[model samples]
Target chain A: MSRKRSRNIFIATCITPAIMLFALFMVVPTFEVFRMSLYNWGGLSGNKTFIGFNNFKVLWNDMRFIQSFQNSVLLIVLVAVLTIVVAIFFASVLTKEKVFATNFFRIVFYIPNILSVVIIAGIFSAVYNPRTGLLNSILGLLNLEQLQRQWLGNQDIVIYSLAGALVWQAIGYYMVMYMSGMASIPESYYEAASLEGAGKFKQFSAITLPLIWNNLRTTLTFYIISTINLSFLLVTAMTGGGPDGSTEVFLSYMYSQAYSNSTYGYGMAIGVVVFTFSFVLAAVVSRITKREVLEF
Target chain B: MKETKRINTDTLYKVFIYVALITLAITIIIPVAWVFMASIKENQEFYGNPWALPQGIHFENFREAFVEAGMGDYFLNSIIVTSLALVFLLVLALPAAYVLSRFEFVGSKFINGFIKAGLFINVSYITVPIFLMLLGWDQSLRQIFDSGFFLNNLSVLALIYAVTALPFTIFLLSSYFETLPSDFEEAANIDGAGYFRTMFSIMLPMAKPSIIIVILFNFLLFWNEYILALTLIPGDKKTLPVGLLNLLAADRAAVNYGPMYAGMVIVMLPTLILYIIVQKRLTQGMTVGGVKG
Candidate 1:
């Protein structure tokens, strides 16, 4: 065979399987998500009608959908804020201070990340069980029985309960991420700051924070996307959007509408909105948090 | 006097840091250790105080979870699916990543762009559509073959897992591939190694660190994955996580809490063991490719 011909064959042989599988599974279905949204398709039936934007029209009025949207936004904000704060603090301390058994803490922190969301759901179910739960029992032991309440049962507190689980799962991953970024900052900068009589907080604010601002901004986008995705996964396992849809998040509701309810088109519509929402949110966040790249 | 006062506050700050760290640590440790303790606890021990230690080691819960709840079968299913998906993923991703990173072909940039776009397509979004598509294909197959094959098949599920995982796998592998100098390929060519020979013998072996990282990361992902497993396999055949989910639901309704926690342990123990073994590599490799689904 000619070299050029063989080269063409090699490339073809190398790329075809991956691209074909990807095109079949990933690309086509993603397009189907967009295409199916335009149809009024019911489950397992040949009753798909071309209903343009009408599914979305109904979605606007869906109180359950609205509730899910609220829950999702609430989760995104809460998980992102809580995880980022705690992760950054721990990341800073672990990287900077001389803490005892830092490796042990890091290892333990990441345990939640490795376990399945289903496991987390089970763990929290135990932790949140109203009668014999760890939380309530602990509160009782601490002589704070008044603080004991339904951790997952009450509609008012369930979303926060879910958020707490998510934040727990997320902090370790993000902390590791931030720690890597923080670890890369030159130590000389910190030494100079300390030499100039700058306290630890000032050194963090001046040297570490500004230096890792770009990393933080990037993770903010990650926080948004993963939080949206994970909230759905957790809700599916934990609550199944329980207590009259109080804990329903975006994808969980979409899963119910599409998969369970067999309202395929409606579910796809929710997917469309979520996809666009995440993209726009990430873009806006990236823009607002954009700072000139710091050179250290 | 000044130095003593300064040291006092400094010591206090250190103590405060320790307290904060220990507080967070306990919050994490207690719940997980609680699960482990609960897993071995007898059914009656779950009644009074969750904080109470198990009166005795109740191995029955694990047996029930393993045999009765079908977690044993699901554990096998998870192992099969995870390993198959990793195999399929590496086979597909490695060559594509190598060619894309090294070779300049027609539409390579566009293919790269396409894969980049695929990164944004989260599995949750297209899961229903994928299910529907497979269901449609199954409907067609049933017309001829008299049975459905697409849904509920482990290999097909594994394939889909690999396909959905392609973009990230490709992205991570290609980034690693792009770092290699052209001299290796040229040397291979001088040694009469053709493209496939070069990739197999030279380039691929060189990508071992990356390959290991990919396997480690995707093993956890595929093992822990349930949403796709739950949606795709809407049958008795289930992965561990889905089985655990069912156990959670069943045990909740039946109030058989022992088996439920046992199921949780069954599902998570492998990942935990794996994490403990390669945690340093896992966390270090995580920075190489940031976001995972």
Candidate 2:
């Protein structure tokens, strides 16, 4: 029952497996990726030659890498903004007592959130199918045929199409988050505001939004991380960064370079850059939203 | 002014709100509906007008997708890997989470932060190094077992799945355990229950709901996972999602689009069923975890 003995027991019973497995699987491999990024390793069965920053310098000159980076940034911003707006709007309605079928609609909206990304990606690509697809067909049927564009093919619109699909899947989860945040807000405030002749929009801006500000902050962080990764998944499944890499995002391009081309060092270099890029973005987001804009 | 506002513009605004909500609902519903309706149609119907209703229910398309396209094998493999990974992830994450939540130590905060950092490091970012690592492990593993063993070389994928699921599961579970009262631990302590004994005997059962939530979330994620499986795990031994991608990528011209859609439906079936069963818990769990600091 000695204190030090108990401490040793705590360490033994608790920390070892978690730290050990994480360090072995996660930490070491992460370090190895960094080291390999410094070398010209050609993946498995390939030789390694340490070449400092060569891959990075080459990445700078690579237009595809730059384009993919642009695509990732675009997705991050678009998904965050669109999901927040849609979520807040939907959440406001659902949280009201008079909104009939609120729970039913909430669950209905969440249907896409619970489904797998691969399947959703398939569903979306089919929706964008050029000939008999839902989008183009609807456009054609409505006599708006001239406005229909090749949703996934026309390089100009492909990234936006991908972003739209992401926003569709993402909004429900955020909506629910906003719902939870709004649930915690006191009803008296809204009632008082209503009696003061405030309208629904006025009540939302004056009351619900400020109350859920912290929740929104957390949602923003979640958005930054998941949106970037989700972009990678969508591109891999739907386009494989295709139509001549028009839809390429950061991770898909890295995946192709490493897995497809077996340019291990180059791909690892991209990985390092992506890791750093995400880390900085997350830090910036957390910092920017750290100050509470409104206090209840 | 209040009476006038209530009579006209307020009603107009309420109608606008209702229309917007219904529009958003359609956007979410139509895609899944399209997939379901397409699954029942023959290729001719699908190709003719995908938006149109199916002429007759066709189970044959599902049969073709399950048998001819090798979806059954891929589905089984995905199940095995996702389940095995969840087990290992739980075994590894729970004890750490329990200790971090209940006990004090010098590096507890550091450890918590360290593991949470995994979220920032996307698996795609580190896939090359991890792939090489698995490939090396497979080399040694193959020598120990016969070369013809089906999943012998593929076991490393389950491990990777566990690692990817680790950060969030641990983060969620530790916080969940934190919300439980300390009296449970003191009660165990007074009864002479050791740390491991206390966790398995009490905390595991007590924290079961959160654990289930974490498991379901991770299961959905691993089941849907593709790029890692595509990169690290090679060949026809791949999981369901990558398998579907391969089917798509092979040749669209030669593909039977009907069966392909069926395969997509088959792939989506498990998650939809699980969501239906645990619909309430999924929303609550995700929202709670989502807003966690």
Candidate 3:
């Protein structure tokens, strides 16, 4: 009995510090943010007026907030679809033994995955810098100067450019996921399909796709969450929610409001909105993708 | 038995596969090659012959990036923050994961779910609030530790990274510990080893692979992290990402692409090398962990 008590104590002691830290740092602050959303605070001042949802009311009516939310949604859709499609395509191609220099190709592609967003943003900025950018320079050499346009500064095409950069960064990660899924597929399934005269394409369609449905679903979930979360860094570096807020996503806009604009209450309200949106998105994805476990 | 026709068709398919794969490889390599070429070229050469190889290898850009841009400090800061955070994450997460995985107790499910739910809270969503909290702490704590406590900025950033890494670390380690046989632990317990002893002496050594995975994941995540570090750490203690941003701002008008590219090359090399070294383990680890979810 004494031994069991000591064991329990040890476990409790081991977990307490972490739990405390997490509670203090993550949970408490999260709740505080929620509470602060109800007030009109200027930040760093004692003059926090009790607004009671006025900030949220402002948030609801704010055009920038609404547009950023839409942009966030659009970004999530574009990045998620592109990443999955590109990843699966690469995964399928790389799995074949006949594919020459598979390891070399894998290494080349994975380079972008490991790069910091700052570096990627820098690289793309150089490549897209209107005057001497590689793209414009190439077009100039081809005597197609009229075709060249400002990639980052151009409001209309900026979002697509940002998406392109994101896809470039993210595709390698999803490819790793898909390749692993493909690797786990049983060889016997392929053998059976081959015996029945199923070609590679048909086999992939019927066998591999269905088999890796779980991975696909998980990748989709990761894509959505990360797209919403991490893409802010790229957006900040590349555009700064710029060319008149055309590329503003929720996170960047919230950042500007809080740090730059000093609209603390409004920023907290946006945070709440972001939290609620993410929670709903996650719950919905999980529900839609939920399936009974496949016994292999 | 009709195997001859099958062989011929297989050969044809092989040719088609190679063609498709080479195209994919070219697409992947082109951008990287472009960056490498630009990094070595002069600004004039870049504009004049963008696609051509550099007229001369300009290795001085690397020096300028390190010394002039103060990327040396940034690199050191990144290393310190990432390493410290990784250590803290592993230390806290391992035991927590162990407890949650090995023992079923009151609130265990809730605790596990709580930690896992953190994965959904998009780090960006919490960044503002967390930054405000840190700012408050910094202001208060500054009086207690004097100016020396400024180094605690790294600790604060590390704490955040460690917390953020908790969900994935716990989730991965729990699955790993679940797969470990209970018999070894039971035997150790029967032989007068306390739970801590059994866990450390028996289970930990066995769980080395999972530990490595945890370390690698935490390392990569913290290393690449920008927003958290940017918000938390002020000037003079800037990490690589923030340093790069500063460099960009300082050079935006001058348009010196050479040193900027060199800085990028420096920042990217560590992660690129680490990725290559651990590519196999990373692929397998993420696949197993990801699929389980």
lDDT, model 3, position B150: 33
Q: Which portions of model 3 show Cα errors greater than 4 Å?
A: A139-147, A191-200, A285-296, B1-20, B141-152, B291-293
How do all the candidates rank in terms of lDDT, highest first?
A: 1, 2, 3
Candidate that scores best on DockQ: 1
DockQ for every model, please.
0.88, 0.59, 0.53
TM-score on alpha carbons, each prediction: 0.99, 0.93, 0.91
| Cα lDDT of model 2 by residue, A1-296, tens digit | 88578766876667787777778777888898788788888846778898999999999999999999999999899989988998888888888747868877988888887766778788887889888889999899899999888898899999999999998988888888889889878888988998998977788888887788888887777887787778887887888898998999888888888878989889889988987887788788888778656655
The candidate maximizing TM-score is: 1
| Model 1 deviation from native, Cα RMSD in Å | 0.9
lDDT minimum window of 10 residues, candidate 1 chain B:
B44-53
TM-score of chain A of each: 0.99, 0.93, 0.93
Deviating ranges (above 4 Å) for candidate 2: A1-7, A293-295, B1-5, B139-154, B291-293
- By DockQ rank, best first, the candidates go 1, 2, 3
How do the residues B159-239 of candidate 2 rate in per-residue lDDT, one tens digit apiece? 777877778888889888989998987898899887667778998899898888888788888888877787766777778
> In model 3, what are the clashing residue pairs, if there are any?
none
RMSD of 3: 3.1
User: For model 3, what fraction of the real interface contacts is kept?
Assistant: 0.61
Query: Per-residue lDDT tens digits of candidate 1, residues A129-210?
Result: 8999888888988999889999888999999999999998998999999999999998899898889999888998999999
Model 3 agreement with the true structure over B1-293: per-residue lDDT tens digits = 58998899989878877776676666556666677666777767755656777889998787888998999988998999999898889788888888888888778888888877765555676777777776666667767865434333787788788987787788889888998888998898789898889888898888899898888777777887888788777557888888888777667769787877777777777887788799878766776675211
